[model samples]
Target: MIRTLVISISSLFLCLFFTACVRDTDFDQAEDISLSPIMELDLIYFNLQASDFYDTINGTPILTLRDTTEIKFLDDSTLQESLKRADFYFKFTNSIPRSFQVDFEFLSEENNITYETGTAVEQGEVSTPVITEFTHIVEGEAISQLTLANKVVVSVTIPSSNENLQGTLNMKSKTTYFLEY
Candidate 1:
């Protein structure tokens, strides 16, 4: 008699479980879902010694130095479509006792400049390093221009440099992207 009672209880519970799972679930609500993701990534970094700006053979001081980095990720169609805005942050630590002008140029595959921005760095010494921070925001029509860039060219210019100059200049930078889909 106990065995029969157990079987009957089990059957009733199974029927109730099946009935509960039959409730209607809305699938159409998924169409209204939206996603917004913010991503930050390192863009560039470099360290420069004072000697790098001096010409050993010519015995002259170089006033400018330039570096270029490819940014192929910006060419992705999906990313271009989803990206709404971008913010670029650059920090410079200067121990060289000379002021600097730094320029960032976004370039296309054909070497045409798509966008450009710049900042000024104050003079500092090894005893006291000067920290300079810069931010560039891209929105509105500028977003389209930024998306077309496939390379970034950085140019650093110093007002005065000498072979005997001491200390170093360092730069760290990052970019933040805001996307909605």
Candidate 2:
């Protein structure tokens, strides 16, 4: 009876020791990632007639255009982890001179956060191209899980004018995601 009790206690201790030594299969890791993506919309046109000025189409105001595009980040699994913060930048360029008001909204469904920014380019020399850039940083608890499905919406408004507004807009986004384990 004494030998059996001793053996049982030793086996229990050995089990506990092995269990304590086991490493976690999943663990958090902190990594910094930078992504650069470019998108272009060609042959964009905005024309508002005098008669249609009072009319609203699909809840959008007259002479206003809106576009929503998905923004990519780290891989799905990596994005599923916690994202401590991110620094975002956008570089906008046009093939021809354009006078319009533009706004950008970055939306994250998981976090229910929107980062909004905008810029306006007044009438410039037609012979010269226009380039605009802006940056936005999100830190602290504002940043949540970032995924590929995140959206970036672009809105442009062109006031009533006799001449039609037309140009190709190119957008480039650079993002640095700081992930936490």
RMSD of each: 4.2, 10.7
Report the number of the highest-TM-score candidate. 1
The lDDT leader among the candidates is 1
Kindly report which residue stretches of model 2 are placed more than 4 angstroms away from their true locations once superposed: 1-62, 72-81, 95-97, 108-113, 145-149, 164-167
Candidate 1, residue 60: lDDT = 93
Clashes of 1: 0
**Cα deviation of 164 in candidate 1 (Å)?**
1.2
1-181 per-residue lDDT for model 2 (tens digits): 9999999999999989888864665434323344433322221223222233224445333666677666654325565465656677666565434466778666765534356667774543435546776666766744543343367677866565333334455556666666654
TM-score of 1: 0.83
- What would the TM-scores of all predictions be? 0.83, 0.49
Candidate 1, residue 58: CA error in Å?
0.9
lDDT of 1 at 172: 97
**How high is the lDDT of residue 134 in model 1?**
92
